[model samples]
Target: MIAKKILNDTFLIRNAKVEDAIQMEYVQSRCYPTLHESEILDRNHFANHIKVFPEGQIVVEKDGIIVASASSFRCDFPEHDSTFLEETDNLWITNVQIPNGDWMYGIDMGVLPEYRGLGLSKEMYKARNEVCAALGLKGQIIAGMTIGYGKVKDQMTIEEYCKKVMNNEIIDPTITPQRSAGFRWIRPLYNYINDPESGFGSILMYKPVDENYYL
Candidate 1:
């Protein structure tokens, strides 16, 4: 377990266990209220993820309460765009993960509303990066939610909004944080998930393990 104390509270970040499934599900539901029920991870899915790739699932707890979690798998970077369900194989992950894949595919990451500003997610990201380094994977890739887009979606195109976010003209609750965490935008994906708030759009982003990783 990775333990730290912040603001007089203790936080623990560690690889998830089967027993943590229920709390993980709870955290997921709380973090993604805008997502459709089918798109959110459930207790059974969390259990399956840990069973399939024990080291790829992680969770954060504060004062003994689960507050955040992330799920990931190994895969080769794809050449074509795909929906979130297709990329994650309907969240089963077993069929899509490549044991010897070149990249770490970040399936999802979430921090409860009350824990959002505490940098718990950042610690989780660090833990995942350590996993990538240990496995010799090239880096991490993900389809990030354009969460703030939902508020102004009818006023502009998804592409235009993404561009604005990219250029710092706008700050997306999701994409902006991802950029701060070192992800580079590749493009926008449509019909990525059932998130009306994001206008059903997601951003394809990548973070190389190192500057020389591609070389």
Candidate 2:
């Protein structure tokens, strides 16, 4: 949470403050046009962490402006959880799925284009894992974007676009580098690429917060 000491002007990693909402939204807008323009998770939604922790959450800042961020929490899969959280007064073992353990899901990760060549994205991811490790989070999961066909700027139709990108031919160019960074796809039963209402090709990428997942 308090990570400024480990990073500096070259890059500053720290927890989010409530007032950083506007700036966080600015960075989010520049990096994720479709998501931001659609107002899927606006600053107000991101700011809701204040309801739990008035300070908001964790943030990855560079030169005083936030480039990326991740919250310290995990989603509860209630239907899959057949637990006794309703009856148990304390958690004896967290492996049972009913709010069993804490994990930091990578809520959003992005960087402005100009700052990219500096390897900021990779560094941000590294920091994310570090934060997860510091808090003993179980793992990190990210909903990655899918951009198909030659190049998004040059692609004419969404069909052609999907074919090329989905086929692993021409990626977003940016997201393609994730392979080397130790991220792996968490396969889903359905055609992840064909689902549009849910946004095409969005898959869960997982990275173990600790070596435990490997064990």
Candidate 3:
């Protein structure tokens, strides 16, 4: 996709282009540490994922260089699950994660070091919502981060996990244009919260898009 500059802008979140690979790699490297490269992701993997699944990967550029990226894609798995990469359905999706259901999925929200706190990440969500609505999708979803049960347990008693998941350190799905667009919020309690395989601070939230929010 050709990059469209936004309003003589300070930032532009546009469709991903083949040419943006280098800058995209640069951002991914900076946002994550070396240790994260094993469990999380690295630059080459990121570029290849976008090339293979362009539906949801987008870049936020300053001038001609990409400084951030956001992923939002659709699938038929049903319910909100973030580790869709764990799916054994298709060979093509082996490396890349494929979220379940006919929904707008968020792989992640990344920004360059200097680009943090500029609301560029949020703008990237707005952009994702726009695409979801246009595509006639029912909802938007993301595997949100949770602060870790161990950390929370440190703050409170074991009995507090349930209440805390809802009242406190939980990932809320309806926190964007998805909320304003009337998408339903679905929070599923999976082993991710208490399992060693799961990363700390990870939960899935889905928001269904309305018929008229962006028409």
Candidate 4:
């Protein structure tokens, strides 16, 4: 696919290249400081993603510098599984990518602080959706962090917090945007990532491919 610029050529969104790994790593570090070092994917992981499912990995660039990125890979899970414990035990892309898996699992996404409000995050999700449709995948899934819940956790439980966010009673810096883009919460995942503020939990979300989606 041809790389396209958005917002009057101020930003460009395109498939990630192996050489872009270093910048992707930088963006991740800047975006998620509270996350443990072990939880963050390194350059090697990003390279592996390009080698495995290049189409599922995307990056956004501003004036030729990488400023945002999203990573995903295909993985299969039991349709009846409620918790996704076994399905997500190893959230790393290299460890979990399944060649024939029917669903695209979003592993990481981030945008630099300075690039916020420029629609970069939404473009990354749209890229993922396009990849899903291209591969004929059933849907896209994300173990999304409740990044805004830390401030309210003292007042309510995690489940309650998610419900409020879903009902528009609250806004999550992370989940709210995904919900607006058509994803819906499926359940809460425990130990989903090594995040301490959110108690290592994430809101599992999914968005089905539209029946008429085309390449």
Choose the strongest candidate by TM-score.
1
lDDT rank order: 1, 4, 3, 2
TM-score of 4: 0.89
> What is the TM-score of candidate 3?
0.68
Q: Where does candidate 4 clash, by residue pair?
A: none
- TM per prediction: 0.94, 0.65, 0.68, 0.89
Question: On a 0 to 1 TM-score scale, where does candidate 2 land against the true structure?
Answer: 0.65
Q: Write the per-residue lDDT of candidate 4 for residues 1-215, one digit (tens) a residue.
A: 42788778788999999999999989988998988786777788788888888888899998889999988889875354333334533434665678989889888899999889878888888778888888888788887888887887789887788778778899888888888887877777766667767756788888878835322
Top candidate, metric lDDT: 1
Worst 10 residues of 3 by lDDT: 87-96
Error of 2 at 113 (Å): 2.3
Model 2 off-target regions past 4 Å?
Answer: 5-9, 36-39, 50-56, 76-102, 148-174, 188-199, 211-215
Q: Which portions of model 1 miss their true places by more than 4 Å?
A: 1-9
lDDT (CA) for every model shown? Answer: 0.86, 0.51, 0.55, 0.79
Residues forming the 10-long window of minimal summed lDDT in candidate 4: 82-91
Report the lDDT tens digits of candidate 1 across residue range 1-215.
33445444577788899999999999998888889988899999899999888878898887678889999988998889888889988988989989899888998998999888878777777788878888888888889999899889889988899889889999998889888988888888988989889988899888887856542
* C-alpha RMSD (angstroms) for model 2: 7.8
- Tens digit per residue, CA lDDT, model 3, 1-215: 32455535777778876566677767766764422333444455556656666767789877667888865446653443444344212213434444444566565567887877666766776677667766666656665443344445556543354345555455333233333433333564344322332233354555555645331
> In model 2, how large is the Cα lDDT of residue 107?
45
